[model samples]
Target: MSQELPTRLLLIRHGESEVTVKQIIGGDQSCTGLSVLGRQQAEALGRRWAEGHEPKVDALWSSTLPRAYQTAELLAASLGDLKVQMHPDLVERRPGQADGVSFSEFTDQFEWTGDVHPYVPLAPGGESQSDFFHRTGKALYELVHSNPGTTMMVVCHGGVIDVAMRVLLGLAPAAPFLLWTLNTSITEFLTTDKIGVWRLVRYNDSSHLSGLPTHTDYE
Candidate 1:
């Protein structure tokens, strides 16, 4: 008998969105759809995947946000119309009262002290960095256990990817970790036989965006 392959996860950040372009603070309330460039990036990602850039996945999952949903739809077009399952748990961290505020105002009001203390929330009624960690961890853990031994693709926000990395590597939620995942970028991981262990295969891969103008906004 042959040993079964470990579960493979392809984590993709959603394409550019109106909120990201306009420099607005969405906190999870930013439902604005993808911009024109965002659409092109999504299509390019699809072409890349269809051209053997990524393995055929058994399931597709996406955050409930409109930007992520639209991205998943566009990418699915190139992957044989892969059905996408929406997961609210995969959505970005909420900024609560700061949801629709301007970026400057949001930053002025909320202290980004997570690097010093991970339990700090962005604002009153918002989720703390620690809260984000457990939520993303639970969601990914369940996603993998439910779909054991298969490739899964999850389209979500950049912050979610950040949390996912921490969750997979058992890092402290509020640690000073900084990295950028470009629009429609790919981050790959694999579940190991050692229970609750995961291996990172790649991070922030945007080769599909080559020769294309890239978005320089948040994640």
Candidate 2:
């Protein structure tokens, strides 16, 4: 009998950015990076991950955006040996020219219902909610396939995280996830052929950042 493979995926949200504090859509935004506090948070997370002495990581992936890149860089730096790769597929929604717009402006300009449901298509002319679901979800599937039975860390955004949940868990596309993932927080999962069996052992874990900012800090 063959041993069942256990794949561990550490999904991390990028650190806070100026636009995050400003509450902008920030999708595909050309100009944005982590704030001073955000860098501190990422460093804290890197230290915790290093101290844990987790299994040798097979890969470190990040969204092409600079914020995601910055977070992954800190983590990889801590790992010392492992290398980081940039994947455009991991990028956040392309908010079109409407990027950096306030919530009010976003709602006013786009044909949105303010569904209060994140997975809903609130960003018109931008990638539809479903499109994002498939894009990020496909990237995850690809990563898992390559590393089968290995541990990896992926740095991305909240939207990608939500889409991944829907794809791997058979959840409704528009339903809200129970995750409150913060900058540098870890969400762990193991994926298998059976989507229903993909286990999320941890969700929105900030044990790596216990003394960091509160949830309300960015919200």
Candidate 3:
């Protein structure tokens, strides 16, 4: 009999960093640590997942960003730390010179007119949408294909998650920005040998933010 693959990944995006709260640009450069509320969000997710899920995870993976790293640490603690792995492929898109700008500034500088309201155009020296998609596919290929356990958790950014879905769903590589990932939200997809038949398990599961004063809302 063929062995059953793992229960799919519990993919999560890190909590809102200070950059998110401030509405500042945080791409690959100049990281923005999580805000106080973001830390709380991380705690909230950890509590819920630890208390709610039945079987524990076989591994915990996170991007190298400070916000993602911290979120992963908190989650690892709650999950009892079967193992923690850091993967550089999971890093956010490098916005290059636009990393420290405000949203208004970003639009004013770059004439972005996509149907997707918040899709940022790559400023000079920054990564284009296609390039970002390429990087995202690379990340998922490593994470999803490399692991075959019953379950695993990978904490990453919203952009990475968006591109990953597009790739897994066999949609065009670029254009769409996000799959509704709120601050500290979760997005799940199940894969099989059949390829392109992945299951869309969940998206933006943020019930833990019902009462938080500083909760963030993403499109």
Candidate 4:
């Protein structure tokens, strides 16, 4: 059974976005491009992979967002012959009308009533916590089941990684937890069928980002 074999996942956060630099609340639907620094980060990560840091993977997947897709493209370029499969379901949490809004404006109208209904949208036209969580979780589950005993790389967003952490750790769906996945950082997970559990091997590894000026702010 595919589940019986160990499935390795290289869960990566996409490079920084222009929205982060401009202090906007751009989310999934946002088509914001990557910052110059973000491009460099993506290239650096690709160089790291080219240097034999990564093993041949069964597949490379990325979110449909411009930032994520761009990162995947750059990384794939460095890893000759690799192609990326873009998945819309893997996109970051959609902020809907909040997309492209200034940070101050988003906060001014923000409401936190998720405790009442996790399925309720975070904002007008935005996805609910439950919706985001389930979608990301389901995508990851499918990735694991479909690949089985192979390695896969996924370029996505911080929010998606957050949801993955919660799902794999058996944490409460909407439990509050602080997490920060650096731009182009790698988070590893291993799944085994015997226990049908996912084990986190590592989190937020950005050794490739060494000597690079850090951007402390991003969505």
Q: CA lDDT of each candidate? A: 0.83, 0.75, 0.75, 0.84
lDDT of 3 by residue, 1-219 (tens): 113664477778898787876777887676767878888999999888778563467788888988898899888878886456888878888788888888778887776454332244377677766677787788787666667544778888988888777776777764534366787787777665434356778888888777887555532
The pairs that clash in candidate 3 are: none
Model 2 lDDT tens row, 3-96:
2657778888998776777777776655387877778888988887678665557788889888888888888877765678999999888777
Tens-digit lDDT track of model 1 for 91-118: 8887778787777777676755434346
Per-residue error (Å), model 4, residue 121: 2.3
Model 4 off-target regions past 4 Å?
1-5, 109-117, 216-219
- Model 4: weakest 10-residue lDDT segment is 107-116
Clashing pairs in 4: none
User: On a 0 to 100 scale, what is the lDDT of residue 32 in model 3?
Assistant: 63
Which structure among the candidates has the greatest lDDT?
4
lDDT digits (tens) for residues 1-219 of candidate 4? 265457888988988888888888777655677898999899999999888867666788999999998999998876675789989899988877888788777666765432446777767898988888889999987877777788889999998999889987798987877798899999998877555587899999999999888983554
TM-scores across all candidates?
A: 0.90, 0.84, 0.85, 0.89
**C-alpha RMSD of each candidate structure in angstroms:** 2.8, 3.2, 3.6, 2.7
Looking at candidate 1, the ten consecutive residues that score lowest on lDDT are 109-118
Q: Against the true structure, candidate 1 has what lDDT? A: 0.83
- Candidate 1, residue 194: how far the Cα is off, in Å: 5.3
